[model samples]
Target: MQSTVNYLWHTDDLLGQGATASVYKARNKKSGELVAVKVFNTASYLRPREVQVREFEVLRKLNHQNIVKLFAVEETGGSRQKVLVMEYCSSGSLLSVLESPENAFGLPEEEFLVVLRCVAHVNALSGPKDSLPPKVSPRHEAVPGQRASSPLSAVAGMNHLRENGIVHRDIKPGNILRLLGEEGQSIYKLTDFGAARELDDDEKFVSVYGTEEYLHPDMYERAVLRKPQQKTFGVTVDLWSIGVTLYHAATGSLPFVPFGGPRRNKEMMYRITTEKPAGAIAGTQKEENGPLEWSYTLPVTCRLSLGLQSQLVPILANILEVEQAKCWGFDQFFAETSDILQRVIVHVFSLSQAVLHHVYIHAHNTIAIFLEAVYEQTRVAPQHQKFLFEGHFWVLEPNLSAQHIAHTTASSPLTLLSTASETPKGLAFKDPAQDIPKFFPKVDLQADYTTAKSVLGAGYQALWLARTLLAGQELMLRGLYWCVETFQATCRRTLEVTRMALLFLSSSLGTERFSSVAGMTEMQELKKVTELRSRLRALAEALSRCSHSITESQTSLSNLRSELLKNRDQVHADRSIQQIQYCLDKMNLIYKQFKKSRMRPGLGYNEEQIHKLDKVNFSRLAKRLLQLFQETCVQKYQTSLVTHGRWMREVHETRNHLRMVGCSVAAYNTEAQGAQESLSKILDQVSHQLLQDRTREAQVSPPLTAPYPSPALTDLVLQMQELCEEMKLLAFDLQDNNRVIEGLSRPPSAPDS
Candidate 1:
């Protein structure tokens, strides 16, 4: 039954009730718009006038979408009592939704995010302006232990309160009201400012206020323990409440409860809240005179995933700290929560590639990243992976989403095909989103990594030292033709010799393919080859240890060489050059004015501070800039020149050593190749004799390596040479590393100004 109040509002429904006031759903008689009227009883007036006035002011001053709108204030005719007319949320409080049996175990993963965003983002539920991470997946495949996505409770309203310099000291599910937004979406709002207060971030509040279940340990001690209210509370007290509220919404129950429960053992509950170590969630037990037994885990009835729990546990444990000092402020809490929300878990179902049946992806992943993941399952390169969309083949890319293909609903698989089988004969794509990818060649990461010209130099390390003799002082770029040409020729010869060494190795060692052709195991040769490999590997390690001092010198020289390389044309490419120029200009400008310009460096730099920088380093003040120029330019360059000249000798010696090894490898290859040929021909003859007569004894004596290389007097010399073929690539990489050393020795000079 409806009741009329002062002929102004008709009380159509009873919304909710607290100790002081009853919220009733009412309709305005004049405009017929619905509003919530908070009718205060005699108990409400028992509070101080200051608290009441502050509450009213907070409601009026706060202007945000997440806050409940204050409509007007009115009084009843018969009782003559105060009533606050506020915006009526049709969807009711989050408390009501949690009360639903379906939500008894907390919201599904999807609903959990909606609640997460409603209250906050990827931060405070704001749009993606540094709020959510770029890859928060809205849709997800049903994986074991992963809760399906669903909407639920939120914290943005509380974030807004903190932003507005107010704290909703009471942040519980009941205080979070919800309204039906467009498309029937729930828009949660933070309400009930009776306990809220305007408090600065650093300022403290003396009074103990807030529901005991969600209160900080300090507040609980005073409120429930009946301790003296001497402990001060900061804005972080509200963070404690948010953690408790979030835990409740996520698991449909309060986190901290003593062995006998809060009501049964109130003092013990206080002990449970305070005594636990930091980052402990859901502290369950500790009765006096009993062994303490507690759990740091959420209840299994909760719907959040293990992945989510891992992410959520740290947040709850940090924010719900008994000690305010350890508690996370709004910023840290918001950032961590925002990061979790920003990750999008896309569900992919491939059509043609059956192995890639279901997969998870971050929405922000580019085509290359997405295909790499696809390749892990299908063995098809990303370039060859084409997803079927809109009657054509479109690859997974930054732009391709569940929305475009219309398989957004769960259980629908994304049709997938591999172009690796060869381009689909009649497959077509329009390429509207510029997703028409180009073919890419197979990549060698190691080769590519060492290929880029080192900033220090780009030639045989020894040639750089030789350049000093051929060209005058290292900075003399014009006379370095002989040095460059010589470096190129040495580099070419080293490669050609290395190839020769490799060819001999392959011919000597019988590979699996070689065994098929030769028709022999060559067991004796294979055994010797293994021993040779072990010996060579040991030798390589010894060489590395001997070159340790040279390696350190190279690193230091390389850093200086990098700095020099940045400005081959020092005035344009060099950053330090520009700084020196700016320092000089400022000094010259101040001198021309006779130091009369009373420009002081601004307290801080902004667009307005440009004017203040002109009068800097005037009169005697200009001397420091000259020192800066000498240190940053001439002095450093000169030091690098001396260092490079010294390191060049070691570089030249190392280059000579490598070339000598290469020449030896070439000689060893000839002996190895002949032995391999003799072994194969002998095996063929033995097989031929056996084929002619099964009972005949066949003699097999392969040709011996007459001029054996390195390991002398070895019948298995051919096998050893062949086995080292694969190891030779490691030698090539070592060669490349040494060649990349700082070799561009040059003389230092002043910046061309």
Candidate 2:
């Protein structure tokens, strides 16, 4: 027995006991590495060899960082009692961490995050590194066929085992070991394979095996195993066990109560089959062919806050998906876990900031209310001599509450800071009957309330207002965008009334309205009305302020779009030009060859040869010139229109602004209409004059019968030349029209200009 232990380990020590094995810690005799050895008890070894083989295969193939390692297996004396050697985890099980009183189970949040990240990484790398290599690596490999497709894979670590016909019938928190590495941090490892089994086993071993707290309802399914195996057990049963484990981690206790009966097995079976699972009892198993109530498992006592509870509740529900098909696969599990973790981080940060803001503001508002009450009750005070020079006589004496103002001999300024509403003792200052109403006007109160509601509803708008209040120009542009959107959403028209409202709101954020009681009430009513109407004039003013930037952004976007289109067109134009040039070059080359051929035939002096060469060369030159002229005209027109349109839009927007400021829309309209009429008149006159000139030329130019060409061909050539000249003239006229449009559309200048 000592030799057998030496063969497996260079060093060894007894650790503890399992249901069927005596566990030991050891260092590899060959490699000087740590491992665990399980010497199976005689009674369990007599049951089946297949159980041991299944456990061995499952552990060997699982090979995840989160899973405990099974190193080697051997038999002792006879094959009746076998021993399994696995990796030794120094940190021990989670149960030890939770149960030990020295460093209580209150794990640090950072520690929890580390565990989550480690589990996620392991799940992602679950499969073999590659298909070509049969040997598996200790490190996770994202090889094909090994990929887990869900975020829940971190919680449910079954893939290869299920595929190979093995099941970890018992999975629980105690079975999960925390291996300490490098620092004091604990790395989780799933251990204890004694109660696991294979699907193909024919032996008549009892199915009820896992710890009571972590067992699945399937135990009841197995109880009627003699009914000819009506249902086939699958991977989901293991997931149910994992769900129970997570519940224990979160609430620090079992979700269900233990059972009691005369016969332990019969009672356990009855409890599993009949009891309504705890409200928080979650796992990957769904009730099929049976009725079962689903809910959250209740805590034994009050534990965490609602927010913290909310953070973990959704995660529990996802792990406890009832339908097997809908259950999280490895890929989905990893993605979801990453997403939830990120959200949780953000929420925690935001909640902290919000709580701070709430506390500070609440204190400030309470103090302001208390001060106002004190000032109302006071008629005179020691500060009256100072008030004579300062001009405002309504200062609340230090430590003055309303109750004190009504009764005490003297008031304190601090009295105003309390939540009490009555006048404070001996509070003496400016009397309410003399001037309180005048200072705290009713209109101011109403305005304040309305402004608050509007600003609150318009979060983005409020942010813009805050930026302005802080005197930030860069943020103002962003604020303006929100303001404009808000105003547009609220108002029916963009006009002076809306612009003025925004202008005022931008400067003071409607704080003036709340300086008095009346204004506060009025403002509140106004806010509710405005919210219902979805209208606010300040938004328009905000938009107008941001107009320059908005216009610029729009112009930039348009220019970019235009430039892209222009580039595409230029490419097409270049291609066309190249094709035309190629054709022209080919024709020119052909013409030269034709001339050479013509010249070679007759000692270079024949009239027909000279005439043929001259005609072909002229035709080639004319085609090249015409193509160049047409392309030039197209490019010039396209370029001019794109450039002019930007200026035109700017002018048009300015004109609209002027119309809003009470300028006559008709005046602007008249100018545009006049420009259009003038352009049309000029085009008509040019057309008529061109026609007259053509007629005169037709009458006076000599009939084309020169250079020995036929009269008909000569006339046709002259007509074609005239057509080209007319088209060129039209291109120039179009340029003139573009300039006219630019002038007409430009915004009006200042009166001084």
Candidate 3:
């Protein structure tokens, strides 16, 4: 790399090259810190010195983080080049970031707000007499009788060239550097003041300089009219450039193309003065069967919130206004945007936390209820003479009478006394006393419940910690949705056996042997079974109701989704039509303005005005102006029609995606309805079996020991258990579908202004 070696600093890398200078990454030999050194060719002598001195004055006085800091200047080498040592922005320029594919969405909205604040700060500092460098004269260094204005008044004043103070003649993305701060946040610094100059109070600034694409409309008028002496621009010209730069940074393209064909300059000037720049509307475009497009050549603002659009559009328009009086001052721009910036910052930071908290509470409660049901089923002892526990062979020792053994043996080869070894591999029953305790170890049922609850609570707390790092609200909500579904699935698996056990208990309660037992213990056990049966029936009924609601919601959401798509298409169509009408109206206004202000070279000019305007052709200029107006109107009208068609198609595709989501929801509802029906039937069958057993018990003699549940009851329990397991899985589906429908149905929150 070409290096610039000074007494205190030595360059190690060439950072960039420009027309007037080459920038290098240099290190201070004394401090060993990296810096940028701009080496300018000073062979032209006075011109380079003046520009360097003016820039040095500005940089030396600026203490703000948003403006580049100057270290020292040295005249070095045989060629008499001036080397400016400055702060090194390691991350390079904002322009580089904007052009990178990684930042296709443009800079974050927060960063744009930061840039606006920086601009406002710069304007504020420039207005104050004390803020200017001690040795440098202020542009409006008061004439003998002129009174000094307040700082606010001075900042807002743009009518008088001298009163408006420092205007950065060249403001563009490439001139803004992005420094990486200690916190890893980007710090933007405005640089390159080579084109800057002080203005006199006696006259307006007449210089036609700065980047052409960012040049003010008044500057264009002056240039095109070839009457620099007749009109001048003030600090509003800098505001105009600021608007162009902001637009380019946000959208990745210039509002006006300053360079093009042979007649590009004239065309650009005409458009700047009389037409709205492309990409000013913030939306994406689509064409039927064609590639997706943008209303503008480059559109970075697509999908941005409406509140941001509302603020940005007017601010940009006011800055780029043809009339300087209509242009916004820094104060006005700040007032218009500060509330919006604050709201956006808050919304961006708080949304994820809100969504996560909401999901956690619901998931935690559902899991708690599910675990309780599993604990209840496992803890209770079986009342039957023969029962299966954890797929193990078990016979109630006290209840296994000769009659129970005969009944069990008659129904299957396995008798009531069948050993665990006799059971099939997969069907071998686990000892409930041992195996069940392993899953819930505490001797006290309450203690086991408490322990499980604490662990679950801790897990949720850990989830909250992890959620702090998540970026977006929508992603967090989706993640929470999955978590809830997973928990529901686990609950369903655990509850499968519990539901069957409850059904068997209900069936046994109606038997003569159970009802005729001559003790309070039997009656209490019967009462407990009766209550459990009621609760199970109620639960099934509730699930059936939930399934019904889910089906209805899915249908409603499908309709709402279709309506939203239609409404969006209609809104886009209306906007396009309105824009076309606006263009035609503007064209007519331009025509009227042109007719009233058409130049009459001989009749209107005073001696000096005529002499200064000698080369101008007023008649030809009017004809060309009319031709340009016609062309601009035609272009805008055609673009609007294309944009309208694209929006309609885009909306159609969006609706199709929503339709697919609705179909998936409908499929889930179908499965959920089947599960709900199965559960209801299981409840009804148990109720009927209990009633039959009660009638039989009243007609027969009481048994000495509790009779074994009939083979029919065992079969019914097993079947109900299987159905409950299926219901558990179906419940998960129903829950997930419900959440999806809710998400689709919920209206979007309006962006805070």
**Reference-based lDDT, each prediction:** 0.51, 0.40, 0.44
Q: Over the stretch 61-95, how does candidate 2's per-residue lDDT look in tens digits?
A: 66667778877776654453566778788877766
- Candidate 1 per-residue C-alpha lDDT over 251-271 given as tens digits, one digit per residue, 9 for 90 to 100: 877788776677778887887
Clashes of 2: 77
**Model 2 quality (TM-score):** 0.37
- What tens-digit string does per-residue lDDT give for candidate 3 at 624-655? 33333334333333343343334324333433
Instruction: Predict model 1's lDDT versus the native.
Output: 0.51
Q: Mind sharing the TM-score for model 1? A: 0.46
> What's the best-to-worst order under TM-score?
1, 3, 2
lDDT of residue 512 for candidate 2? 29
The per-prediction tally of clashing pairs is: 30, 77, 7
For lDDT, candidate 2 versus 3, the one ahead is 3
TM-score of every candidate = 0.46, 0.37, 0.42
What is residue 523's positional error in candidate 3, in angstroms? 36
Candidate 2 regions with alpha-carbon error over 4 angstroms: 1-13, 28-33, 75-81, 102-107, 113-166, 197-208, 220-232, 258-308, 318-344, 347-753
